[model samples]
Target: MYKKLFLSCIFSLLAICPILANGELDSCESEVKRLCQNQTESIKKTLACLKKNHKSLSIQCRKEIERGVKQEVQTKPPTGMLFSGGGGLGGRFSFIPLIKYQGENFGPLGSDDEDKKTRLRRQSVEGSTPIGKIGGGFISTSVRYGVTRFKEDQFLNNGTKVNDKLEQLELGINFNRPLENKKNINIRAQYGYRGDRIGGSDYNYSLMTGYSHPTESGRGRWQYFLMFSNNGPLGSNIPIPGVMYFYRTSTMNLLLGLPVLSFQWTPENTLFSLSLSTFGPFYNLEVNYGLVDQVQYFIFSRWKQENFFLSERRFEEDRLNLYEKVSGVGMRSALMKSSVGLELRAGYSSDRKLYLGDGLFNNDRGSLDLSDTLFLKLMLTKAFR
Candidate 1:
């Protein structure tokens, strides 16, 4: 009887080991634990646990893991997607969809693949601006930071750690003057630089010109703007048009814009804002919790993201791809012109192969594959009217 049980365990190991090695086992962690909770003695128990819980697994988790078991597995792109260039920061506030920037992956390739060789890492900042508008559109300035804390601990085939850190900074300014004082119309021009270090202009730069006009609508007011940048991520930065109507009443604020749209409901000292556009969805809320000195130091929280780029290619008859994505969340003191706070972010990279499978998510994010990135963001902005 013992011999028979041992043979059953052996067969089970044969079925599960490859999937576990591929890193597709995370989704089923809880299921695995519950099924094999007390079976720590040997492989036999763990194998039985997983098999028993097979029916309860997530479709994605089961599909990826089982794909490896078959001999006729469909090919996937090379592991590791990489990207380089500039203007990636311009998409910062865009709500429109765009062709994401794509490149070769750096650092280690697939987390499961053998012969781990080349390693890569990076870091940077996002949306940091100082000194807001002056006399309508006099000087609009901003500063942002970023970083790639590459996985240095992972070694390569030759045992050499290729751990490296990349830091980036972006500084931008816009100058403007009123075209007509009575109409509240202003002409604006902008210049910006993105660099590897802090000195500025290591890789990217931008120049643009535009106009802003506020006019009377049927029952309210309308704010209008039109501009073109020279080095935008979308080719040569063509004409981008936007409009806005900012009106506030007793219990609510109506904010409508062609390029950017948002709605806010402020009842008493509490505020709630909801926004959705070409980019994605954004939600925020602020309330005076008296967390400070009770000076109406309203506490605010926000959820937003910047989808950098994603692309697919064919190499040596095999598919290749790259993905760049950024997500952020923060808490700050509510100020109409300036606000300061802390944000957290995550990103990833790979070297050897392209992400071939359909990916855990969809192409809406540029690529479904991302890994090994963690960092904190410092944000500060000041607006001058």
Candidate 2:
């Protein structure tokens, strides 16, 4: 009986050893699969996280993952990143280029022939950049080139027709420094050169110191500006022949004035402004007043997968004592990605003289005249990082 029992125990041990071996093999396979899945998931998450946080991520890590996901994201570039700030030195500098043409009609009424005048104009690109910021004040400089023409009608002297033209090239610089934390109490200086076709050139220089104080409600503001200017001819030509009388005489001119009230209203993409100023000569103290108004409207839209913007501006100025008025309207359009644009403008001006003729000898000259102008402009721009 003892021999039979011992043989049965041996059989039972052999059977259990095979079952334990199979279970161990299955567990090892399962552990290998879990580790492989975890690694794959981690790599995918790292790539997605890096792109979402471009500035926060480490450079080395981003580069490594970008290689793996290049195919998936390459076809789809980021939107709203190109031309983000409208193309400049990363918010530093900007420029404006313009071309214009003007026509003028001046003559005595009821005359058989009316004098017609025309001008072709071009101006250099103008630009501005911020230099530095100090405390509550900032400094900026602007440079520009202005070219224009003035046509003179020939006088009827002995029935001989003569034509005269005035051409000018103006290079200008403008500098401003603000004080008192309000942009009030500022100083400005400017210098320019005017070249004439007749003979010599004129030099213009001016310095202005001004201040403004706005009421608490901001509905009304008052400003006072004092300006000193020098206008005279340059070069070795003393008593230049055929030069305008005003150019030959070197004079120190003074302008003192107060801008009484100004108002502005802006809603969404539209802006409107109006201002009235009362001015006079500081020496003779002649009283004169002027009114200026402006309005701008703009719209932004997308069509045919291209972004576009359009704007229009209307400007008007009236001088009461001088009896002169000018008004103009302009329109501009541009594409989103291209650094090209088109502009059109039209203007009308009328001038009247209260007193005219030879140095207090002739009678008062009263004549009404009209002028019209049109302009087509093109622009080019670049951006810096």
Candidate 3:
């Protein structure tokens, strides 16, 4: 993954310097001198005059000017005005409206032994800034909380079900420092806790860190990045890479790179998206759509192949192979007022692949089979733009 991220970063960096690429600025050097003949006062004034004569600028000069103008416009928002949670990659930070909140409830998907219930709920709030630039470096950080509940067969002596609920606290950050003209370094890290309601699994935690280059491509309209995080089976915290290409047109956005491929059409109040089997799109459209679309009538179904783990140590024991698949279809609708939206969804899932793994119930290499199921979801999100 790290290797792929590094390669993609290199390619995306190549994608950013359109001015230097075809010598756009070089081709327009003579134009700048000709247009601002009497103005040797300052580079800023000269550029301003050039912009005023924008209509008559040559193609290359216009392209270069447009790129700079686009970036300049964004800078007007003040340093910490904006941040992204990574396309479904959970992120935070913003300047204009730096606070955001989201909450979602996942319907019960199946039953455990003795037929109780398994359910989940999640909520998170994130804040960060693009305005925190200090000595050419800036950082964006975010935190989140989530919980899950399952029917754990039986209860403990205190009447509290042991290991019946899973809770997590998450933290993440993205930092950058300029390297040279039009290039900068990108670094990110995340820590998560996935424990039970009453101190269930002490081994339930994941930590990852990544490094890459921060780049803006697609004619200066979007940011593209290549990143590699160290959390694979082997806990080596070394840099490896993976990439996802980003291109934002007036109507649609496309992202494609090894292990990552997806696209979304965002013309207005409506959005249509498709996610591939690669790393880029997996939960993006599926999960995000379920989370974002609240105003329209929508239907969705997915077949997910998943691995079940009792603890992180089970990974080393090769016991992580407990295979499971949940195929479900759902319909959703949304109600909105300004920046706040509420989404509701209901569906049915086929849990036929629940127990397709390798081991028995003691260690549960494979899990138990679940018949058919019905579920619902309610989500509320507030956008601060």
lDDT for each residue of candidate 1 in 1-385, tens digit (9 for 90 to 100): 1211211221110122223321223344444555566874564555555545544554433332322221111110011100110112221111111111112234443455432332343343334122334664334344445543333333323232222333434554434344442233434333333222345322334443433333443223455655453333222334656566655443333556543344434344432322222211333333322111011233333432221111122221111122333333433331321211122222332212212213222222222223433233333322111
lDDT of 3 by residue, 305-372 (tens): 32223343334332221122333333333222233444456666554323322322232433444335
TM-score, per-candidate, Cα-based:
0.40, 0.38, 0.52
Q: How far does residue 327 in candidate 2 sit from its true spot (Å)?
A: 4.2
- lDDT for each of the candidates? 0.31, 0.25, 0.36
Summing lDDT over every window of 10 consecutive residues in candidate 3, give the lowest-scoring window: 7-16
Better of 1 and 3 by TM-score: 3
By TM-score, the best candidate is 3
Off by over 4 Å in 2: 1-125, 130-137, 150-184, 195-201, 212-222, 231-261, 265-329, 333-343, 347-385
TM-score of candidate 1 to 2 decimals: 0.40
